[model samples]
Target: MANTTTTTPNAAQDTLVLIGRALIAYLFIPAGIGKLMGFAGTVGYINSVGLPLPEVGAAIAILVELVLGIALLVGFKTRWTAIAMAIFTVAAALFFHKYWSAPDAMKMMQQINFNKNIAIAGGLLALSAFGPGRFSIDKK
Candidate 1:
């Protein structure tokens, strides 16, 4: 008699991947919503960084964080979304969380945020390489 097992070894892995995606999305979705709600403030913050075209920067950030974040949460185009998010996270860390140049009073917090962004980016890159697990829309 042949064994008939429907469950794959990847069940746990898929659950973990889904959870990871949700966690990552949780970080960005609210942030994107906050930015959208406070568009003027977001633009002001971008301008404070002396980046050119602050409004454009804010718009792009909103699109990436909100749209791609949703895509990631749902496991849609997971690999590409993860890659884009990784790039965006790194860029944000460099531009907004520049700990090296931060004032002494703010240095520690800035460093923490910068490191967090880098870690998130690393996770995203890993997700991109591994692909979304069996639970993801990409797999289905």
Candidate 2:
């Protein structure tokens, strides 16, 4: 005897995944565009953080947040994109949101930002593991 089980498309789950992708994309796409438009300001901020090669950093940020961010939104190469975004988010939190080293007045704000980045990274990791769902170009 043979046993069989049927699998059905989950429209709700797929829609939720698309919405999650959109929300994540919203955070990076505008941020990337802002950095691109204010190239000097972005470089200056990177320099202020005492990171070398601020220009290179800014360019890489633009590429990751803008280009790869759009890819994430469209669910193209989503697993790799999500993984890259997750890693970048964690690195950025560690480098830029060093709340432990922040002044007393700024510590709370920095900590909040750091935690937020970590949470975002968690979401991205989940996306990477589960994939972009049926609504994505990847599924097509």
Candidate 3:
């Protein structure tokens, strides 16, 4: 018989989970860091949206994005972090993106952002269901 090597499904899944974690974290972490560094800008933008307590909202956003993004990146508390991020993404899409009411000139951009958030939320939900995989802090 000829010798052959085959990769296990679990190994493939583990690599995919790691890649997913890194990609999502890449999307969130820089934005979080930028928000933290430009606190005044984030606060001003939040206030412009007419949401109450812009400072509080900005702080909450910074914490959730940075902390949860890091947790997802390192595969720590995977399911819980993913769930939290998913909820956060949905809320942000509704409250901030609101493409349905945008003016015609900006409507398409806002709609794109809103849809992107929803897509990201779906990915997060999937990550929560599948978890961080074997090469993670939550590994068995």
Candidate 4:
């Protein structure tokens, strides 16, 4: 006589956490590389937005995307990294992606950036509150 049981909640949650990490990693890798290689004209674009410290902001953004992307991918300090990223995301959306009252063409681009930032920010917010689960460095 044998009995079968479903996976525990922790196991399911662990899998979900891994998926979330993967999602963030995939999204950020290109961004990190772009910043690292000065591709996509992101640095110049940041400055054009009238940011107070374009170089410093660009450097910080690169570091966050690289370091935090790696941390999230490996599930290390998941909550903390996620929280920092979430705040960063919101700040970026608010500052550069301001859609309201923007010109038609600019509005389209701002809308796109704004939407994507909000979505990614939501995921990071979830990670901040829910944690990375047992399949992470923080767990060990």
Candidate 5:
């Protein structure tokens, strides 16, 4: 073949971003299902944490994650869904994982999980502003 080169500054970023969104959506699906099914133990934990309207909050969170995860998976209204999810994730990290001055193991675990969520939320924030790549319903 003749010499050929095809690359763009945004191409890799777009591909990685799409993959990241897909993975996040995939993980959320099961978690959402757990919440949707009223996993009694989980709801109990939420209540124990003193979340206001704990049951209702759990339900809403389930629906938001499930529905928005689906939407994000298909890249439909990608930006909006990403932004909404970003907000939810950040809130969850703050509310549930804000362990300070705890045992080192627990604190480290919480910090890792919390930071992971925040990083994902950051990706979502970028997605919300950038819109999905050419491979999305937002494009169609």
Candidate 6:
């Protein structure tokens, strides 16, 4: 008799992991592309937030979202890339999404964004712990 339960779950696990990677990477790719397209505006925003070296910050953001993001989507060196992304996510949340200090009108939006970043970071940490699963380049 076929051991249907075990086999199905493993296949499902691979597909789910791939989907998770895709969704997470999807968020970054468009964001990175937007930054590339609007470099000056991004720099202005970064500067407004009082981050040092807005240009450098923008560039690092681009690299993390586009370059490292692609690597993550492909599950290439998943754990390392996930860790980097997790760190970046936390830093960005702290730097850019300080909703607690925002004026009332803007506070809600910033709070949502801040919480979202934390959630994404949590997902990245989970990925780092689980690896890329069976279908990934870092296949377990």
Candidate lDDT values, in order: 0.94, 0.96, 0.92, 0.86, 0.82, 0.92
Give the best candidate by TM-score.
2
TM per prediction: 0.93, 0.93, 0.92, 0.86, 0.83, 0.90
Per-residue C-alpha lDDT of model 4 across residues 78-130, encoded as one tens digit per residue = 88899899888889899888999689879988999999999999999898887
Local error of candidate 6 at residue 139 (angstroms): 2.4
| Candidate closest to the true structure, highest lDDT | 2
**Candidates 4 and 6: which is better by TM-score?**
6
> Count of backbone clashes for each model?
0, 0, 0, 0, 0, 0
Question: What are the RMSDs of all candidates, in order?
Answer: 5.2, 3.2, 5.9, 6.0, 6.1, 4.8
TM-score of 5: 0.83
- Give the Cα RMSD of candidate 1: 5.2
Model 6 agreement with the true structure over 1-140: per-residue lDDT tens digits: 86666333487888899999999999998899899999999999999988999999999999999988998999999999999999999999999999999999999999999999999999999999887777778764
Task: Please report, as a residue range, the 10-residue window in candidate 5 with the lowest summed lDDT.
Answer: 6-15
TM-score of 1: 0.93
Model 6, residue 5: what's the lDDT?
69
Tell me the spans in candidate 1 whose CA falls farther than 4 Å from its real position.
1-9
Candidate 2, 8-44: lDDT as tens digits = 6599889999999999999999999999999999999
Model 3 backbone overlap count: 0
Locate the minimum summed-lDDT window of 10 residues in model 6: 2-11
lDDT of 4 at 3: 75
Per-residue lDDT of 86 in model 5: 93
Q: If ranked by lDDT, best first, what sequence of candidates would result?
A: 2, 1, 6, 3, 4, 5
